[model samples]
Target: MNDRRIPGPLRRRPAAASLAAVALVALAATACSGKAEEEGGGGGGADGVATDIGVSDSTITLGALTDMTGPYATLGASVTQAQQLWADQTNDAGGICGRDVELVVRDHGYDAEQAVSAYSETSSQVLAYSQFIGSAYVNTVRERIDGQDQVLVLPQAWSADLLGSEYIQMVGSTYDLETINAIDFLAEEFGLGEGDTLGHVYFEGAYGENALAGSRHAAEELGLSVAEQRIAPTDEDMTAQVRALAGDGVDAIVVSAGPRQAASVAGVAAAAGLEVPIIGNNSAFAPQLLDTGAGPALLANYYVASPALPIGAEEGTPAELSAAYAEAYPDDQLDNGVAAGYSAISLLGQALEAACEAEDLTREGVAQAMLAMTEADNGFGIAHDFSDPAAPSSTESYILRPDADTPGGLTVLGDPFTSPLTDSYTRE
Candidate 1:
């Protein structure tokens, strides 16, 4: 194994182009419509699909379809916390364009039907959907956002469909790319042989499927074959899944689940007796998973992605973000989901900021602001430019490995690698 996990500052960053903040212009869009009505939504969804109805006054109301309970609770919690931190920071710093932000949280319990109801019920009131989970659920309500010309989306799942169209802006690597990122790092940085079979254990849902699709693509590209296993989210007994994987002599396993579901599958996979490495989705980096009584099963051979810096995990990235969020929310967990939420809000803040600058606070205007944003610093990773209508996406994904040794608990590998821009996403 020729593991090489060092900083590669040699890679040039994408030019600081303008990002599209059409949401900010949303206020202007409604304003320009003359007889425009707030209609209750804050923003649109997928390809500028109107998931959120409209916004009135300077205060923007954002609707969210979050997972407070069920499979993704842990990750959902982090997503919520991140958004909360952003709101607090923005509010404290005098909010978007001198206007206060009104955020509404609705629990989806990781259910698609519940998600649709939550979005439908709240869409009429907020301007856009924030921190909503799953592509399955997002697709359910995509048209509503489009019909109203609203922008409703954030940086969550790595679904590939978001890469095209103007309705949605997904801010991470695509399914194929994110999955490839982990394998790429495992092989290039961790120094593993291409002949090894990459074991995959995932839920039978879109979240897991998207990853599976991506991993399969990458594996083929990397000259690797995959040993696949699917398990129910609620099934506690993973003896079947793990044993099947072990029987196949799997080399490495990448499991995707929120927390509870992840713990169930990870525990099974670890105890499956192969002693292979067990990797997980970015959401699996929570302390909950490590402390799930799956000790050795996870201790050394287990790793996951720290999408955002863990509370105070590493320096430069983690510490800085931690401090900012801590100051924003003096009392909170500041765990995994919060970090993601914080980043999402920061992006939204930038969108709003640009919208204010463009004098386009209407739905279309804010969408314009979100999409036309040239360049602005929101204190996160890279300076995103959403000016390109043809290819509306940003590729900024950080790689992290959290182990027992690090005092802060997580170790960041290197600078975030840019997902192929052409294959990136557009925030709806």
Candidate 2:
């Protein structure tokens, strides 16, 4: 649970000597094929694989625009480190597409301006973005990434607003769907139905607003009521918000903000004698929170809904990744971010390998390869279909309750599930 900030941009490349030999061979094979040179900024490799901006004879570059000094600073650090570990493992296993994978990381500190600036600065150098962390920031450059550049971008944010872009790959269920599942879990827990009211406290941005949409839809379907409280990302103290929800007599509260906000909501609500179930989206809970003052309250009443299995899940991939991540960074705390970051890049690596097999490693090639993937699984207890650009990878979410004794501080309440209500959800 190191809360230290990463000061500047960091670049990482796998150090494998075999990559040099592979590069020499590619250069030799493409020496006479000047057609790649004539076609803008690409070249041919050993397997006649076409190369582009991020792809070279020996390396393929990807970008990671993350938040290391802002609201999700600690989570962002774990995710970034996990991606780096994935890169190392991929290189060790004979690099993808006959080249080593390199990650060029930029920390945007969760500022919109800094996010856009980081994207602008690194977009040209990388073949695609492996990890873009913010919803609004990604939206700001959606047109450019989807229309102009047409490079594949796997975003860490899961707003339904990000869907339908041909090149933007969403790995998990969107925020809205995740919220629907969370609200349902809460309702079922409290045995509330038609007459119950739920309070939703969320950030005033793409991420929170998207989840709020879910709460509204769930309310409509389940014949319930929703009371909304929108707050900025900087508003950490939840005393006022909790009291407002308490005044509304909400049976349960849905929080779609960061861990700080979630903790505040739990602490304030418990202190105010506002005894109601509290739920949050995937990014809302962190393992370190169990060591805080709100730990008991969270363990008693808080729940989280996530699109993927957490690091503590007793699944094959989660088990493997948890071990690898711990070994890679012994001092770092185990969290779902490690699982998320690895999953995102592992999927991207699959696309890269597919592009190489298609003999076109250009941005367009990688994008097409991704779209063509009808079935993809990273062994995270769920299967994803990338064939549809208008829909998210999956509609299923794993409902979890906080447990102080759990490895990741949360335990799955049941198997991953897709609510029947999800089928009626229309992506907006």
Give all candidate RMSDs, comma-separated: 8.0, 10.9
Model 2 ranges with Cα > 4 A deviation: 1-40
Q: What is candidate 1's TM-score against the reference?
A: 0.79
> Each model's TM-score?
0.79, 0.89
The deviation in Å at residue 101 for candidate 1 is 0.9
Return the lDDT, model 1, position 181: 61
Query: For residues 166-264, what per-residue lDDT tens digits would candidate 1 score against the true structure?
Result: 546665445544565677667765554578788887766566776787677667766788988777666656668777777777777787655555455
lDDT of each: 0.60, 0.82
**Residue range 1-428, candidate 2, lDDT tens digits:** 11121212211121111123233432343333333224336767777898777787899989999999999998899889999999999999999888999999999999876776777667677888889998777777665676556778999999877777788888988888889878767766687679889899999878998899889999999988898999999999988888888888899999999998999999999999988899999999888988999998898889899888888878768888888898999998898888889889998888988998889999899999888887788888778888777777887788888887766777878777766666576644
lDDT of 2 at 360: 93
Candidate with the greatest lDDT versus the true structure: 2
- Whose TM-score is greatest here? 2
| Candidate 1 ranges beyond 4 A from true positions | 1-54, 189-191, 306-308, 316-332, 374-377, 382-392, 404-409, 418-428
lDDT at residue 175 of model 2 (Cα atoms): 88
